[model samples]
Structure formats: C-alpha cells, structure tokens
Target chain A: MDVDRLNLPSDGDGPVFKEPWEAEAFALALGLHERGLFTWTEWADALAEEIARAQGAGDPDQGDTYYQHWLAALERLVQAKGVVSETELTERRDAWERAAHSTPHGQPVILKP
Target chain B: MSHDNDDHGHDHRSSDNHWSELTLRVKALESLLVEKKLVEPAALDAFIDTYETKIGPRNGARVIARAWSDPAYKARLLTDASAAIAEFGYTGRQGEDMVVLENSAKVHNLVVCTLCSCYPWPVLGLPPVWYKAAPYRARAVREPRAVLAEFGVTLGGDVEVRVWDSTAELRYLVLPERPAGSEDLSETELGLLVTRDAMIGTGLALPVASLSKRGCP
Candidate 1:
C-alpha cells in the first residue's frame, strides 16, 4: 500500500495549518523530537542524502520526490541499529490477523493476542 | 504550554461531536434513497467505495495516533503493521505488506507513491482528495522541502530528507517517536499528541510537559 498523507501546516515558511488530521500527527512528532529523542536536523540530513542517492540512481520521481527515500532510511536505521526487531514485525502481523478477523461493526478492533 | 496563539489545548473532538444538526437531512436522504431502492443490499459495497474515493488521510492519521499511544501494539505494528492495523477492523483493498518507519537521530521518514498513489487503505482509511491531485503528487516528490515548507514545517540545511519509492509489494508509514513528559498519560492522551504530519514524516509530536506548563487541563 502506498502511504500518501495530507499537507500539514508548518510554523515559518507557509500556512500554519492544513488538514486537521495531519496537524495532529505533526504535533506528536514535534513533541517527540524536542525532548532529544531525535533531532530534526539529523532527519533532514539523512533524507536529503537519500534523495541525492536516488537521483544519482536515476530516479524517475525527480525533484518532487517526497518520502520514499525517508522510509528506506528509517528502515536502514531500524535494522542497522536494532531500534526495532524483525521478529516484532512477524508477531504483530499474526496479532493483527486475529484482530482483523474478529472485530465487528466496521470500527477498529483491538487484538486480543 | 500555551499554543503560539496563547490558547490552551482543546480536548479531542470525538467523531460523535462532528455530527451536524442537519444530520437529519442526511438521514432523510439515506432513508429516501433506500426506500426508493436507489441502492440495494449491494449498496454496502458503497462504504468501501466511498472510503476509497472520498475519505482522506485523516483516517491514516487516526491509525498513526493509535499506534504511537500503544507501545506493545506499536511494537507489533512496526513489525507487521498491516496485520496489526487489520486487527482494528479496517482493511483497504489497496493495503498489503505494510512497514512502519520510525523516527531516529540518524534517519527521517516520509512516504510517496513513486509510480502512482498506492496508499494503504485499511490503516489509513482513505487517501485524501488532495493526495491524488496531480499537483500535490508531482510537487511533493519533486521539491519535498519546498512543499513541506508550505506545510509550515521548516528544515534547515542540517536536516536530511529520505523519500521512499512505494511499490505494489511494500507500503510505508512514518512512526514518529512519542513525546516526552507524557510518561504517565493514557492511550487516549498519548494519541492526542499524534498528528498526520508525523505519519507522513513532515512534522513531530507535541510535548506534554510543555503542554502542562501552558495550563493544559
């Protein structure tokens, strides 16, 4: 599945708010970063480097290329550094199947496992 | 803490709160259509259709919030997000082997449909109307910084951006770190800290201690 989200507002360069949902997500990330868990500077640098690599590789997406590189970078960090484990991915997948198959009423179904 | 505008935080506006008084009109239409047989039992298919066609990234935002708030679950999510999200009872025909990319000091995360917009539906619900807007799709992948700037997210030259090329086999979501000083918060409160921008890796979560100092109730 492709992950395409909405345009969220920023503080300095443009609109302060865009879609309500994206705004909420932005608030959470900002909160996490400010506490020194991670720095936006590092995030920006890594993503830029990834984008450059992609460009060198002849990416067709071009300048408008958004987060694809970022996602891959995150994966590299997680796997390389063990931020999160691969086994976790498998366990969660099994749990999700249990939850998805059991929930009712077209709402989110919390998994029991 | 106070918002830039000095306003204290507001409580979450639950889905229930959004129903308009004119909702009766909507109900009336639904009944009218049903009675008129404009749609049949086969019409339930429309829920999936409408979700696929009309709903936007807000749905994805909701899913991200849930994941950020629940660590054990989030752990499961990052590992096999598609299945974990499916446990919540939302499944999009378009969603599959989903991977959640988390924020870290060395890496930043963002997602784009390199070929076309192939978004995860079950977890994100639906792609926002603008996501498919050619201008946005073209502009987002082209000048991410410039585009992100329009979103009010400014990254200095020191920051690095990594864009992912989404394929039919892989789907991605940005799993931003949880905010600090909120170690005591409930799942709901933690969820309040999540934002759509974080999921797309354009922004960060809000801090709770700072929020507390600002008279957050």
Candidate 2:
C-alpha cells in the first residue's frame, strides 16, 4: 500500500541526526511497534492526542520538543497498556537523573541496584 | 564527583531541563516496558542500529543516485517524488505526498516544519534534533541564509533560496544538482557522494576523491 499521506519535512536530506538521544527515541517508538506493542496508527493517534493536548496547554507547537511529546505519549500508552505503573515510571526517571549525575565523564550512565 | 564531566560541562542547570529530562523519561519508560516484557532492550538496540546505519540514509542515497545518473528518472522524481520513490518500495508512513525540490545554479531549496517535526521517514528516517528545534524552525524561514551559514552552507549571491514549509499534507525533499566531474562515476559511486546534508541543502555532495577516502560502503 502506498502511504500517500505521510508528509514529513525534509530538504531531501538523508536522515540527519543532531544528537544521539533523538535516535534512541526514534528507535524506541519503532521498536515498540516491531514488538507488536502498538501499531503505527495507534502510535500516530496517541501522538496526535499528545500534540493536541500540548497545544491546548499552550505549547506553541513550533516544532521543537516534538519528540518530547512523542515520549510523553509513549509513556502514557505504555502505562495504560499495563507495561508499567505511573509511580514506577517516575521512580525510574528519578533513578536515571541520579545515575546521570553520578556517572563519570565520557561514560555511560547505567542504572544500578 | 561533581557530576560535571568535561563533556556534559555546558549548561549543567539547563541540561537537566530539555534533552536530559526527556532522556530520563524515555529511559524510565524503556525500563518499564522491559520489565513488563512488552519490549526487549536488545530488540530496541537492533531497531536503532538498523536505522542508524543499515537501512536509512542509504536508501535515499540510492534514490538520489538514480536521479543523478538518469535524466528520465530525475524528471519523474521531480514531477512525482512519491510515485518515483515507490518504484524502489520506499513508500510508507510520513512519506506520503513527497515533493522533490531541485537545486540548481540559480535556486536553492531548504525545508522546515513550523508546526512539528514531520519528516519523511520512509527515505530520510528520523530528523536531526536541530531540525526539530525551535531555533532552526523559527530561523530557517525568517533568515535561511543565516541558518545555512550557521550550518556552514553559504550560497552564492546569485543563487536564490526557497524555503519550503512542510505540513501534514506535503513533505519536501531536495534533489541537489550533480557535482562537477561526477559524469564518469557509477550510480553506486554517485550514491556514496550524496550525503544526508547534501540532500538537506546544508552541504554539497562529496567530491569523488573524498568519497573513496571516507571508506563508505
């Protein structure tokens, strides 16, 4: 099937990644879809909802933090899907913050027990 | 001990604000997904790796190569990029209604999404963070030459720049003019010279000599 509706912005440039983390975020969404955790349509709907919600909250929708909203939608759906609880998600987020702060320079910040 | 590494030394305070915060949230979400067995970290890594190197830019490179080497194909790509791209089975979500913009000696094309980071995933994959940032989005349309200069792209004074605003209905891709002395190069070799930035108008395609020096596959 031809997806004639997928209109993304580009100057015919190859997939240029500005940062490492953005790639990770893109992969996460694709990975989740590959694992059958969600369909692209579902993901699209969720992402659209999140964007709408952000706009309603006066996000300005200037194209920055688009992935932030993407991650937010992923979190909401994963939580709703029973993959994780809201409390657990927050705890883990805090843990990463701590890990990032504690880890040395030029090293990966992995969570530890 | 201060958690201030030389690498992440810039903006320690604001660092915790945008990218870092989103990163932590994503990491947390990944952990939760993994814990629930809904997703595997390995699968995630593989997926990212695939897009990072294997399947993304190269696909676009092939398309660009074809257009460069074949005038008829080039005409088709400029006329109907979506249909032309589908010939190679590169049609999918976020790639519908692709409009190929041709760069020439007189006109240069740049693209941006003012509303969101709607990128052509089928051929280009995910967009760079800067492309999705407010600074680039805001400045690209207002002062394209300045933004391009920041990216080290300085157009000739004689060349006019056209900025395409991407919406949900139309996506823009740039088909850069073939570099000089590339006439003898094969399609594969031409593809090698075509970089993501070249297509995005931030940089020119690599010269044939540098193409081999770069050790691209």
Candidate 3:
C-alpha cells in the first residue's frame, strides 16, 4: 500500500522506536489507515490536536514524548471513526493492566477467556 | 496497587510506570482494533518492518554516492530527482515528489519541515527527532549557520546557506559535495562515507582519512 502522506519520526537508519510499544503504536496507526478507517489528512489533524493539547498542558515539546502524542492521536481517530468506543477502549486498557499484573516477569500479557 | 517490595523485593516491576502505561495502552488499542477486524495484525507488522528494515538513509547514501561517481547520473538526479531515485527502486510514500539540492563551494542546502515532519521516506527513511523538534524547526530557517555549527558543521562566510522547508507534496534531499582525495574510491565505498546527517545537510560526508582511521579499507 502506498502510504504517501504519513510521516514518522526517525533517526539516521529509520523510524526511532525507543520501545517495542512505540513501534506497535506507529504500525497500528498505519494499519488502521491502510484499512481506510481514516485518511492521512485526518490522522495528521488528530496528531496535531494531540500535540497542541500536550503543549497546552505544559509538555516541554521535547522529542521524547512524540510517540505518546502519536498513540493519543491513533486512539482519538479510532474512536472518532466509530471503529471503537470510549467505553470499549477504557475497558480494554483496564483488562490489559490486570493481565499485565498477573503475568510473569518478561512474559507476554494474555487476556483470559 | 501496594502489593510491592514484599516478596519480589528489588525485583518489583513498576507496572504503572510511564512507559509501562504506554505499552499497555498500545497493547489495548491493538487488541481492540484486531478484535473489531478494523486492522490486521499482519498488516501492522508489515508496516513496522518496512520502516525498520526495508527503508532508510542507506538508500539515499547510495544515490549520493552514485551521483559523485557518475556525471550522467548526477545530471539526472539534479534535474529530475524522483525519476532518478526511482532508478534505484526508491519511490513511494513521502517520496512522491523530490528535489535534490546540490551543495557546491558557494552554496549549501539544508532541509527542514517547519510544519510537522514531512520527509522522503523512500530514500532518507524517517527523519530524526531533532528534525521534528521545535528548536531545530524554528532555528534552521532563522539561523541555519548556527544550527549547522551545533551539528559540528562549519561553513565559510563565502558560502550561502539555503534552507528548504519540506512539505507533503515536495521533499528535499541535500546532495553533499564529495570530499577531496577520494576520486579512486568505488561508488560502493563512496556510499560508505555518506552519512545521514550529510543528506539532511547537517554534516558532511566522511573524508577518506577518517575512514582509514576507523580501520576501513
């Protein structure tokens, strides 16, 4: 797929994924976009909104927190597009936290049936 | 949440730590999206892999090295960057439109995306954090010489620094001047001297002496 418009943060080699989750978040946004959930313009707008909101909240605007804004934008767009609801997102987040706690150290967190 | 420092002692995991929270949020989002069939996990992996492995500055390095070695290729690159870059099989995404800025004795070119981080992903991959940060974005256009100095690049007063602001439609790549005393180096070897910062116009290509110092042949 031609993701002609999407721009991502990177270093010399490529996109700088400081953490595994950062890459996952970045990819998830692309995945949703590829599925035609929202246009690249919509994604850009949502990301800009998140960045502005963070700045308004006294975020230093340093590069370190970029992906946090990215993740926020992805979540916002997914909800705004009606692909998922706020309640579902919150419930899923809480479920993941519980799973994370019960999981062994360094083991993948798995939601129980 | 206070079930810590008893059994595991020093090994207690800060499950609520900032990164951990982010990790959980991403996991939750991915899980929800997958379950809803809005996004496939394989597609996500493909996107990540494309950026992480397939695309990067190395592609741009080869382009620059080829330009340095072949006059014909250089002409094509400067005249029609997208078409020339396509010859190397690097075309897609942010690279739909491209302009190769040639650095000469009298001129230097630097690229910045003042509005967001629009970059040529096909060649240069994603841009560095500093490129997207507020400081570089504001200062690159205002005080380019000072910005270049911070990146350890110092040009003479005779040189004019031209800053190119990249947009979603057009992206710029700096074709750094080839270093002297390296005419004998093959194109592949020349590519090894090209750096990501050089293509971004933040630094210069490595000289042959430095390569030898680093035990490179």
After TM-score superposition, the amount by which residue B119's alpha carbon in candidate 2 deviates from its true location, in angstroms, is 2.3
Q: Tens digits of per-residue lDDT for model 1 on B42-161?
A: 444444345434544555556666776666887888788777777766554432578888776656666776434556655554444444334455666777777666656676676677
> TM-score of the B chain in model 1?
0.63
What would the DockQ be for model 1? 0.03
**Stretches of candidate 2 above 4 Å error?**
A1-25, A31-69, A76-113, B1-46, B93-95, B207-217
Which residue runs does candidate 1 get wrong by more than 4 Å?
A1-113, B1-41, B44-70, B156-158, B207-217
lDDT of each: 0.52, 0.74, 0.81
Per-residue accuracy of model 1 over A1-113 as CA lDDT, tens digit each: 12234433232223222332232222222332343434544544454556557766877442233434534444344344444445554455455444544555446545452
What is the descending lDDT order? 3, 2, 1
List, in the given order, the native-contact fraction of each candidate. 0.02, 0.39, 0.46
Which DockQ-derived CAPRI band holds candidate 2? acceptable
Off by over 4 Å in 3: A1-15, B1-19
Most accurate candidate by TM-score: 3
Chain B of candidate 2 achieves a TM-score of 0.76
Write model 2 residue lDDT over B78-131, tens digit each, in one string: 888999999998886432489889999999998887656666767777676566
TM match of model 1 to true structure: 0.47
Model 2 TM-score, 2 decimals: 0.63
